[model samples]
Target: MNRPTTLALTFLTLTLAACGRPASTPAVSTDDTSSGSVADAGGHGAGGNGAAGHGDHALAAPGPDRSRLPSRAVLGPATVAPGLRVQTLPANVQPNLLALKVLILSSGPSDYGIGTARALLDQSGIPYDVLDASRTPLDTAALIAPDGSGRYQGVILTDSALIMDAGNGTYPSALDSAEWDTLFEYERTFRVRQLALYGAPGSVPEDYGLRYVAGAETATTSLRLNAAGQAVFSDLKGAAIPVTYSYTYPSALQSVPGVSTQVLATDPSGRVLAATSTSADGRERLILTSAQNPYLTHSQLLGRGLAQWLTRGVHLGEHRRFLQVDIDDVFLEGDHLTSALTLTAPFRLSGSDLLNVRTQQDRLRSNYPAAPNFRYALMFNGGGANTAVPTLCTNSPWLTRDLLSSVARCLNTQFDWVNHTLDHQRMDVMPLSTATTQIQQNLSVGTKLGLNMSRASLVTGEHSGLGFMDPTDDGTRNDDGTAGPKQDLGLGRSNPNLLSAAVSSGVTYLASDHSVASQWDAQCPTCGVPHPLNPGVFLVPRWPNSVAYHVTTPDEATAFYNSLYGPGGLFPYWDRNLTYAEFLDRESDQALTHILNGTPFPHFMHQPNLRQYAGGKSLATDWVQAALVKYSTYSKLPLNTLRWDDLGAQVRRHTAEVKASAAGTLSGTWNRSAGTVRLTSSAGTVPVTLSGASSGTLYGTDRAARYDLSGSLDVPVTPR
Candidate 1:
């Protein structure tokens, strides 16, 4: 006889795999002493002559003129820097119709100017058009609208020489008098905004009224923000942001009369590092010390803040919350496997097993009666029951004929099929060819079985094969709960070959094993929101939970504890005998920590979770249900079960919206009318919570049974 579901839950040890290697040394170039030239950097036209009318000699050179320049206030000759002077811009109601488009001015290929600019903008999901000012010069036709209406609302100058001649910088070519006049005239007339990351000496012309004096080269600098600066630097408000510039330069501003200028940040010596200015035409201009890379948090935040400022609290679309729950180690059940091994191995759960699992899943649906579907991502390993043909069972009884196919048909149609690898091998240990082949082979097998396994999500076998996060404890087990000697598996470094193989196999969202490093952040490669980590690949992580590797009876549990926690054992302080109740308590605590973060909940489980043991005889279903119950009761927000791919897509869109929206802006508007709750957002997708509508029919802009923000911006929820 089996115990009731309530009492069947038990604690499991953390599941971990170990591989050891020396830590890798990051490559540091001693040769990058100076910024690359625009010509050498590969800007579109560093060496070529620009379009016919925008040539260098198109107009005669003009003498320097400062009569119309903004008033200059030089207070930096003193010891201590004055309070930050920043002019915050008012919210612009004139919506940017071309919110996705931006103008990128680069002089050379991957030059620090354009290269750094591209990296910053890549994660914002905003598209851009590049005009290599070096090769093709800027003329009145390109800078000003034919009908006097500006063609571009904003411009990012990677190469400073675009507006003025920075002889010592990347592009040495100076713009003609006509070009310079055209550029300044368009900005002042059209109110087009601009962000200048860096400039060579004399690069900032008097027309802009900025005196930039290049400082000594340094690797790092501390940047302090002021009150006015906080409003524009919303992401870094109330906090000092440290910036890393390959070559740090100290600069000062010559305040122009009648123009509002504010200092956003100051350097260590009390010099202005970042500042914003407002033109007479109400246009905004931002200048930074140097071009920053996206790898740094401050840099990413700066890029996002700039986008929101330029767009004035608008994004690609609305916002939507995504939840992706993955069930790992799905395989045919086998006989004689240890309870612990079973959790990680296979079991021949007959077709009836599928039905019973479905029955328990239905129970979960009952709680959210209004939700149209409950789905799971089955992360499968392909080595189980390897047959010449795609057969599930090859025994005399043939308990599971065409097992995977039948199982697929029985599962909820919305469930996702993820590739867990062909033989469940640690991808990091295998050769690139083998790793690539394993993923491809598994995908092929699933397709042959009509499983329609997608290549989007890869849950690398055994503690994330390409190790991004390794357990903090030593690899050995002890008698007490205390750990053994600390172990280090050179997992800190990313494997380029393995990543390339994963990308080739069509993996976009790769799962990571979460750590307690941060309250909410887990250890996933380039985790958090989607950025340009590996082009299209987005790394996602699962909260860490203790794993069970063996079946445990009260006596076995005692033995298990004594073996690992007893005196001189791996861990010596733990209780000699661990109870099932204690296990559940610990698991609950771990799950709660993550749930409170209120982001996506991607609880992971393995095959043995469905074993007849591990409490409740349906360990997998029991664990999942337990999680759902906790999430439903404790989370402040509503929850939706989405496939892994869909969840990735949602994150990508949400990141864009959050970057584009102003601080404290709500996702969208919800209007309840005629017994229907209508949802709408100017952004992309809106995650609308529908309470007391468990029995309601959710309708999106389309007629889909489920309510997904991607399908339509406006979704109507009506009672069934």
Candidate 2:
């Protein structure tokens, strides 16, 4: 009685096959102890020379003007300690863009002449980072520190940003006389220099790092680095460009509906006081908003250009989030070695590798910026007719230890203990005791290794392959051996039975054993196939179309998803891929497109260490990044929430809105608008929207169907 249907779909302990189960399935260097040069960021040439024009006599040789002569060039003068030490820029840049390396003798919160230069760099999108002089103490003692990441394209000031006072033991906001002389010495070297006359003329010294704020008549008379890494006269003016606001509208998300947006000004008649608008892409936008927008609560305003604009000269488009994920599972000594689905995460085996566990953790961290969704699940084997636990199952314990600790260090990615099974025993052979033992050992090891095994959402154990199925975990081979409980894709009565088994044994997310696209079921499967690994998506079950490994192929993977998610079928069915890598990429790409398209992202989990998804760097890390990009784009939600329940709800909401009409129709509403179409009916109202439906309207009686639906639809008003 393999009755597989949408109604049978339920959450249970699931397992994915390795390839298809049982059945199938920083550069940096520098002894200088200073940050990299500004030229490294490329803006060197006012044109793009890529490097600072090499230092030459042209820069060192000052004009014949007697007054402009160096004020006695000195380095770490014994009489006066803590002075400036100048160094050549590490790299060169375009001549147009003035670049140099200025060294400060000490640390200061304010500029010795650095702030002005920083402002210019930020405005130009030139890369830069600040290094504490303390990190490279040697450079500081010598009045130079170029060992940091910033390459020498621009000004490098040593201990210049630091302003310290010895007499009062507290450096004031203003610089001391000695500091002025140091910047003055570099004034001649600056490709562009500024000169300011003091009230006392020659008596006054150079004061660098200070710039004209709101209202200033002339540059600081003492010394200062102008916008161009040059010393300028008090009357010298640097370029200042008003900031330009820019936003992106992706072509992918231009059609979803139901999103209503508007632009509003604070004072009604006020000129663009503030405004919120929506574009084809799903992103929501608000401009000129006050720092006090309550809706931007809980630090929402912290990013999204507000804080960045305040601190950095430019605003962020959208920041990407990164995370590392490792597969983990505790195991006992009785789990099977070659069973259809092996319980690896929480393996009840005799031999397991502890270091392998740490390596899994390392893999996750490597994809840090990519924000990989790391996870661990137990792999379980299903018994079709075998009896007695396998002897080889005992070795699993030693093999599982390594993965356990790897997952314990991080919580960003999911780490769910799955149910592999006890003694690697076949369900048909052993009694309920087998499932119990597997769960116990799996949970026990997780506890021992410090994993949060208390609760998780994926239950990948025995016969629990990747996809949902029925008869897969029914009563098993009965005493008669006539016909085991009905079986199909694990969605039959077997599923509920499996759930009861999971709850009784403490397991969820049942992995469908042998769930991959097999040669037998690869033909346009109702549940989608990675199991019984096959060739094409449309071949019949009886055909000889074999697996293309297809995942490695671009086209095959696409067909698999379309078949399952296509209209009028397979709604909200949980499915798994043949390998960890395949699952990672397919799931992430799917979720991201859905999000970018403004559609709801589907909830899916990958079993790390499952040979399939965690194979190579490109496959593992790339897929994880795809997932992170999708998650980050949402901007307000976490990755975990994209689970069964949330996805179920979204499926329904979007389907109705995408298929039905808008609201206020009977209320004599004129053109409601695009994306969000509103309609009015005697019963109630129905509003429809999707990720990219620019236009379309329809009304009808609601019908229960797959894919999340709120139930019922609205009647169309022929413009009554």
| Residue-level lDDT tens digits of model 1 in 1-720 | 110001011111221112111111111122232332211000111221111100000100011111111111011111111223322222332221122245677644424455446544444433455786547766655643333334454678753444322333332333444454556566665556687755432323432345556544455666777886666655344555556433444567666665566777777777666777775556577776544433333444466456545534322331122345566655533222242323322344444444455556666677653233666677776665333433332222354444544555445243577887776554444467877887788888677556656568777664334333223422232111212211223333334556677889888876654431221121111125342335665656454333332322323333443444345434343434345555444344334333332346476654444444432336556545555554444222344667777666655444444343322222322222332333334455543333213343332211112233532344333321
lDDT of each: 0.44, 0.25
Query: Where is model 2 more than 4 Å wrong at Cα?
Result: 1-430, 454-490, 495-497, 505-619, 626-720
Stretches of model 1 off by over 4 angstroms after superposition: 1-323, 332-352, 367-372, 385-414, 463-492, 516-533, 549-578, 614-617, 632-637, 656-720
How many residue pairs clash in each candidate at the backbone level? Answer: 56, 199
* Model 2 worst lDDT window (10 residues): 54-63
Query: How does model 1 fare in lDDT?
Result: 0.44
lDDT of 2 by residue, 53-155 (tens): 1100000000011111111111110122344553343343222221122122223332122332332222212233344332333321132223322112222
